[model samples]
Target: MVEFTDIGDVPSAEVDRMRAVYQPLADSVRELVDATIRTEMDADTVAAVRAEIDAATARLRSRQIDGAFGVRYTTGGDSLAWGNPVIGVRNPIAPPLTIERDLEDARGRVFTDFHLGAAYEGPPGHVHGGVAALILDHVLGEVAAHADTPRFTGTITLRYLRTTRLGRLHAEAAITRTDGIKAYAVGHLADEDGVTVEAEGVFIQPRWARG
Candidate 1:
């Protein structure tokens, strides 16, 4: 598993409490996004629903943060990347990928499984190529973070082997090698049938982010 020694100073109990309070709201928002994309309601009904949504938005806007919710952590060494665009718990536009990492090993391997709905449609019934890249990019980054070595993507190249359908998908990434400050990693995305995308990336430990 990756380490967050330099991040997430909050308490684990507090983090869990916050998630318990907010995850349901986030889930509802995700559902709203899916419904909005697939709704077959009439124009008038849509307008009315839009009005209600606006009202709710206004209510939430009454109290707001001034900036993005960056990565946060707990005293117990847990970090929550909740505002992440691809996996954030508080983000509705995310595929909301749930990642699992190998804590007992240092290979920097990570895996995730998620379902893409109508909100992620492209190429008719298929997922957008860019979306696949997004998922792989994030996973590859994590794969490079194995053994708590924090890094950022320097470059990533992806090849689409086949069209990914709009349903259950799986992805995995692992570090292939490392050279000084550079970590090379490879990953792939697959559906039930087989591989759909392959990616390799060079992750760099930025000077500024290093202790």
Candidate 2:
């Protein structure tokens, strides 16, 4: 990863306010995605809905940002990774995760709670295996960051233990070992029944951070 300076911070209240506005927008878009994929509407109805969607899309694009939204933080120590594609609150494809650190109890462990809706469907009733890997990679990478040993994901290997159902899911990761700048981590994703996927990864702390 290229070295970049921090973007500084915004007030927590401002961050919360922005989240309140955009989070609901993301939810609405997610609903649109789910409906688009699973709708049983007839041809005419589908056409009508597409027309409305196109209109809405045009309105939103009327004024647009030039590029992607990146992570930001506040001087008060509040950080928002809300623009992340996998877990970002403003992204419809995201699982919209709320991750927590278990720094005191498990040290390097991190856990995330999220839901997978119909938009993530694969194999009729289960989430796409690739989506599972995306979630794992983010959480496993965050595990290193939470431990104050941040790194970019070098490689990730996932074992789909079983089909992950379309519903509430939990994931957890912790650093298992380290060799030089490489941090090895392992984790799993589970639903109400049990774990459906397992993952292991090596994350590399940049040479800049090591110094």
Candidate 3:
């Protein structure tokens, strides 16, 4: 069995090069997902496309490592969490989110310019509310995890301000306040028009969590 350790084991220069190569492939796969979900075709045509997609997925799966893509490190000093639900590099299910963290201000932001195909449509032509909430929760959690004070979500509340369209979108979060054991945060999801969903959350450090 090939066991891997920290990414720091990998040389920084090598990691950078690897990322540059892999990122484009990941982006292409994301586009494939969007196209698959939104394609409008007759029954026979759709079936043929599904078969092709299945074959392509199988080919990729043949080269994948078993289980989840856990945090991996190289012999140098590079690290990557390619299976992170919010920012995994190879996960087609998640939007390409290059999360930026402002440790000084305790803020997390992700700007996604991906399309939400029919699979994400809830109403006539709008993105699903639940999906929006999921993205907000993940973004807020990342913000709270900053300061090396990671906490799990204890509660989250979301308000749907407007219908989110299927095109490009932006999401941002910031720490509002922090008590001794609880961190309060607020986030917003917006599009070219304006804010669509606003969220507030309380994250708690578990009893055993080290500060």
- Write the residue-wise lDDT of candidate 1 on 64-170 in tens digits: 87677777665577777788889898888887999898776577589999999888887999998989999999999988874456788899999999899999999
TM-score of each: 0.91, 0.89, 0.78
Query: Sorted on TM-score, highest at the top, how do the candidates line up?
Result: 1, 2, 3
lDDT of 3 by residue, 1-211 (tens): 2234464555787777877887778878778767876678899998998899899879877886677677686665455766665577766666656666654563444334444666567997898898898788988887776434658899999999889997787888888888888888898988889999999999987776564
Top TM-score model: 1
For model 1, what is the error of residue 45's alpha carbon versus the real structure, in angstroms, after optimal superposition?
1.2
Residues 52-163 of candidate 2: C-alpha lDDT, one tens digit per residue: 9899999999997667676655667765666687778888877688888885955478898888988788888899898898899999998866434569889999998899
The best-first sequence of candidates by lDDT reads: 1, 2, 3
Model 2 has a clash total of 3
- Candidate 2 lDDT for residue 134: 87
Q: Could you tally the backbone clashes for each prediction? A: 4, 3, 13
Global lDDT of each candidate: 0.86, 0.83, 0.75
